[model samples]
Target: MTKTYQIQSYFNFLKRSTNQHGVHSPFVYDLVTKCFYDKKKYPAYQNIKAYRQHLLSNTTTLEITDLGSGSQVFKTTKRSISKMASVAGSNYNDAKLLYRLTHYLQCDSILELGTSLGIATQALALGRPKAALTTIEGCPNISAAAKASFKKFDLKYIDVVTNDFSEAINGLKTNHYDLVYFDGNHQKEATLQYFETLLPTITNDTVFIFDDIYWSKDMTAAWNIIKQHPKVTVTIDTYKFGFVFFRQEQAKEHFTIRL
Candidate 1:
C-alpha cells in the first residue's frame, strides 16, 4: 500500500488504458463518456462535500476492529475520526465518481460491504437517496459513528448494520442488489469468497464495484480471476477500481480505462 509505488504503477496503467473513443461497446462507451467522464455538476455534491468536511473537522476517536487484512496506515486500535478521514477515506474525486455512477446506473437496491467512516457510503446514498441501501461494517464504533453522520446529513434512509462482512452478506440470501460496493476486505481469498457468495444475487443489470484492485499482488490476481468468471460479461479496470457488469446480451470484454 505504498502511494509512491501505486503512483509509479499508474504510468504503466496509463499506457494500457483507453478513453471513450477506443471503447467499441455502446454500453461501455456511454458509461465511459457519460458517467465516468461526465463533467456535469451534480447538486448532491454539496452534501458529499459537507460530509467530508465534517469528517475532517471531527475530533472524536473510535476503537476500531480489524476483521480483514489489517490497516497499513494505522498501527493501534484507537484512531481519531479526522485521521481516518484523512488516511482511510475515499478520495474526493472517487467519492464524486461513486455518486455519479450510482446516479447513472439508477440502481434501486444497493449494498455496500464496507462502511468505514461511511464517506463512500454517503456518496452512494446521495447518489440515489430513495434506494433501499444497506451498508455493513465490522467495527461497532465505526458503524455507530457512520450512522450518526447519516442522521446529521439527513440520510436516515440508509440502513447501517454492524457485523462482519461474511456474516452480514450471508444473511441476505433472499435480497438482491442492483448495485454492490465491495470495499471492506482487500485480501485475495476473502474478496473471491465475497464475489462467489454474491454472484447468485446479481441480475443481468447488476453492477459491482471492487475497490483497490492493485492493493497487492493477491488483489490483482483476484481481479484477473474475477474477469474470467463466466457470468462477468464485462469488466473495466481503472487501476484504482474494478467495475464488473453482468449483461448476458453482451460479449465478454475487458477494458483498461485511464481515469
Candidate 2:
C-alpha cells in the first residue's frame, strides 16, 4: 500500500513539476537554476559521500528504538549499522542536494530534526563548516552511533542532542535558524505540531525542508496544510523533498520542481 501510494504521488508530482523556465519569481528562479540544478563537483561532496560510505562499510549491530512514524524499510529492532546506513539514511542525490543547498543559501545556522546515521547532518555541516548546527535524534543508541561517525570523519561545528524533538525545540526558542531540515516524525500531527512550534524561530529568509513528503497520504496532506499556512511565502516540492520558505517580501507561491 505504501509503495503504491508513493507511485501515484510521484506521478502526480511529475505532472505538476516544472523547470526553472516556468518559474517567474526571481528568488525561485535563482534557486532552481543556480542551486537545485547545479552540476558542480564540490570538494565537500567527497567528504559527504565518504561519510555515508564509512557507515555503509560498518557491520556493527545495535538494538533499535524508533520514536517517529516507524521505519518503512526495516522490520526488526535488531539491525546492523550498515543496514541502517544502506536502507534508512538519505541517498546520494538528496545528500548532495543538501550540500549544494547549504552552500547556496549560505546558511549561518541550521537545525536538523532527525539525525539518522547523520547522513543529512554530515552533508549540512560539510556544506557549511562555519554554520552552527544542532541535530536531534530521539534514540540514544542511534544518536551515539551517528555521533561516533561524525567524530570518525573529524566533522566539526555540530551539537548532538539526544531527546524527543518536543523537548529539544523547547530549549531552542530564542535561536533563529537560516534553515530547518525536518526528517524526524513523518506523521501529520507531529509534523504540524513541530511546524507551529518552530514558527517563532524563522526569520523572513528562513527555509524549511521536509523529507519524504510523499512517503504517505497523511504526510502529503501535512505538506498541503504547510503550503497554505499564512507564514509560508514560497514552497518547492521535489518528490523526495519539500522546501518551505518564509520570505515575507515574496508573493505566496507553491512550486513543484523535479530534482
Candidate 3:
C-alpha cells in the first residue's frame, strides 16, 4: 500500500464524492439514506465480533497456498492463524458493510470468490441466514480453518469449496446469483477475467462487489474498466470496495461516496 498514493486518491475522491443530499438517482439516494448511512447496531454484530476474537486468539499454524496476488504484509507460506486473521481478514467496518448490504438486499443466493478465515463469510451468513452462500478458498489448510470457524459460529448456510477461483467458478451449477463478491484475485488480468467469465451468471438484479479496488494501480485500472462496461448501470466507489449494479431500470451513473 502506497500511503502517498492513497492519500492523494482519497483527497480526489472527496472532491467528487457526495452524501445523499446531492444524489439524483432515486435508487442510489434510498441506498445512501437507508443502508449506507444506517446507524442501527444490528444484534448480529456481537456474533461477528466474537468470531473475530476467536480467530485472533487462535495460535494454530497452517501452510497457506496463495493463488491470488500474494499478501503485501506476509511473505512466508507458513503462518500462524492469528496472524492471517489479523492481516488478511476483512476489517470490522467493511465486514459490517457487507452484512448490511446482504441484509438490505435480502440476497437469496450469494457467491464469494475468496473465503479467507471466513470472517466476511460469517458476516454474510449472519446478514441473511436463509440465503444460500458458496465461498471459495484456494488453500485447503486455510479453507479448513474457515470451515471450522463457520461450524463454530453455526453459520451453516455457507458451503466452503476448496479450489482455485477459476475452477470453482467453472464448476458452479447455478445459472445466476443475486450477489457476487470478488475478493480472491487482486491482479488486473485475473480480476477482469473473472468478471467476464461471471458476466453470464448475472441477472439484471445482481450486485457485484469488488474488494480492495485501490490495492494497486492495476486494480484501480480494472475497476475503471468494469465501471465502464455496458452491462453496469450504476457503480459506487467507496475506496475500499467498488460496487457494481446491473439494474435495467436504472440509468447508467457512477458515484464515489465517502464512508
Candidate 4:
C-alpha cells in the first residue's frame, strides 16, 4: 500500500468530500440518506458473515496466478486461504455496502470483474437472490476455490468464469449489465480499456463501481478520465471505491462523499 501518499490524499479528500448535509441534489441526497446510511440489518448479512468465517477458518494453500496488478501485501504466489481472506478479500463493511447497493438498485443482471475468494460475490449473490451474477477470475486455482465456496454456501445464482478480463468481456453474449464491479486490473490502460469496452453496455440506470481508485496515481487518473466521459452523468467518490452513474435524467455532477 502507498501508505504515506494515500494518507495525504485521504486528507485532501476529507477536505473536499461532503456529508449528506452538504448535498443539494435530490437524487444524491436521497441515495445518501436512504441507501448509504440505512441502518436496518437484512437477513443476508448472516450468510455473509458465515461465509467470511468459513474462509477465515480454512488453512488450505493454493498457487496463485495473478494476471492483473499484483498484490500489494503478498510477495509470493503461494498463499493460504485464511491469509487471502483476511488481506486480499473485500472487508465486511464494503461487502455490506455492495449488498445494500445491489438490493437498493434492484440489479437483476450483474457482472463482476474479479472474484477473489468469492467474498464479495457471496454478498452480491445474497443481496439479490433472484439476480444472475457473472463473476470473472483470472486465476484457475482461485476461481476453483471460489466455485467451491459458492457451492458450499448454496449460492446458486453466481456463475464463476475462469478467464482473463479481456477475454471474458469479449466473450460476453450481451453487453448489457445492470451493475458492473471492476476489481480485476489496476493499471490505467487496462482499467480504461475495460471501461471503454463496457461503455456501450451501460443503460440510463446502470451503475459501475471501480475498486481501489486511489491504489495508484494511474488508477486515479483513470477515474478522472472516466468522470470526464460525455456519457457519464454523475459520479460519487468514496476514496476506496468510485461509483459512476449514467442517469439521463440527472444533471452532470461529481461528488466526493465521506462514507
Name model 4 segments beyond 4 Å from true.
none
lDDT digits (tens) for residues 18-78 of candidate 2: 8998999999999999999999889888888888889989999989889999988889999
lDDT at residue 137 of model 1 (Cα atoms)? 93
lDDT of 4 by residue, 70-184 (tens): 9889999999999999998999998998899888889999999999999988888777888989999999999999999999988888988999999889877466899999998
Best of the candidates, lDDT: 2
Candidate 1 C-alpha error for residue 43, in Å:
1.6
Q: Determine the C-alpha RMSD for candidate 1 after optimal superposition of all C-alphas.
A: 1.2
lDDT of 3 at 25: 93
For each candidate in turn, the TM-score is: 0.97, 0.98, 0.97, 0.98
Q: What lDDT score goes with residue 171 in model 2? A: 88
Query: Can you tell me which runs of candidate 1 are displaced by over 4 Å?
Result: 1-8
Record all residue pairs in model 1 with backbone atoms less than 3 Å apart, i.e. clashing: none
Q: What lDDT does model 1 reach?
A: 0.91
In candidate 3, which residue ranges exceed 4 Å CA deviation? Answer: 1-3
Q: Give the poorly placed runs of model 2, Cα more than 4 Å off.
A: none
Candidate number achieving the greatest TM-score relative to the actual structure: 2
- Each prediction's Cα lDDT score? 0.91, 0.92, 0.90, 0.91
lDDT of 4 at 234: 93
